[model samples]
Target: MESRRGQGSLEYLFMIAAALVIVLIVIRVLSGVSSNTPNQQVILYADPENFPTFNTSDNYFVYQTTVTKIGDDLYNVTFKAIAKRDLSHVKIRATLMCNKKPVYVGDQYLTVTDEVENLPKGWYISRYWSPIRRDEFPCEVVLYVWVG
Candidate 1:
């Protein structure tokens, strides 16, 4: 009778221990899951090939290239000549190319009224790369300038 009672008590303890183990596993599985984490995703912008154009006719037909702001993806460049042919008595024309592709081709065949005479002519220009072709040729000429 004593041995039977001990066996019954042992079974009861084993059942309790099994239940406790299951409960612990359930708690661990539940706690391991997280709901507080965020969905981390970021989006960026795209860049165009051409936007700004520079014209410096006073500096020997040299057109300085404007810096572009590069963004995320692929792009097709666009060009519109902000014509500065009104600088001097010299007529000008420029052919713009990017990656060996012609973008903008412009010509100033007609000479505009000289306004450089109005401003005291001592090689007045704002650009650093611009050089004044002083006394080189005051008269007009058809120039095939390449701007890239």
Candidate 2:
């Protein structure tokens, strides 16, 4: 009877140890998933009220530039442009900067069908990968826009 009781207690100890190991494994997996998720923020140099209207003229106006993180190190950037005067063609150029360093640059050509009078035309940039560290979060993002 004494030997049986000792064996039963030993079994219970083994079961408890197994449960603790399973719990630890679960915690580690959850923490890994959370760490890989991207956290993002955008900073604008110009005033919000005057934004998307940084400059305007009888020819063209550039505005509404934004950068957003879509996934781990992935981003989606967009901006707006408006035509003030009739033109045969137009070109839009964008430069994305992080921590005062250029990370991406792109350009697009616009046709007459792409815009309307007094209406803003939208441009999008997708899947931009940024190589930055967690400590650099909420990093300053600057977008430079030009139309020609």
Q: Which regions of candidate 2 are displaced past 4 Å?
A: 1-59, 72-74, 100-148
RMSD of each: 25.6, 19.9
Weakest 10 consecutive residues, lDDT, candidate 2?
Answer: 107-116
Q: Residues 1-148, candidate 2, lDDT per residue (tens digit)?
A: 3544345788999999999999999999998775443221223322222331233222344334444455665444344444444433333333343433323432221111132223334332222323332223333323332322
- Estimate, for each residue in 1-148, the C-alpha lDDT of model 1 and write its tens digit: 3544345788999999999999999998875563222121111111122223333333333333332332332222222122343333322232222232221222231211212222223332221111112221121122232221
The lDDT per prediction is 0.30, 0.38
Q: After superposing candidate 1, which stretches have Cα over 4 Å from the reference?
A: 1-63, 70-87, 100-148
Error of 2 at 133 (Å): 7.5
State the displacement of the C-alpha of residue 48, model 1, in Å, after optimal TM-score superposition: 11
Q: State which candidate has the highest TM-score.
A: 2
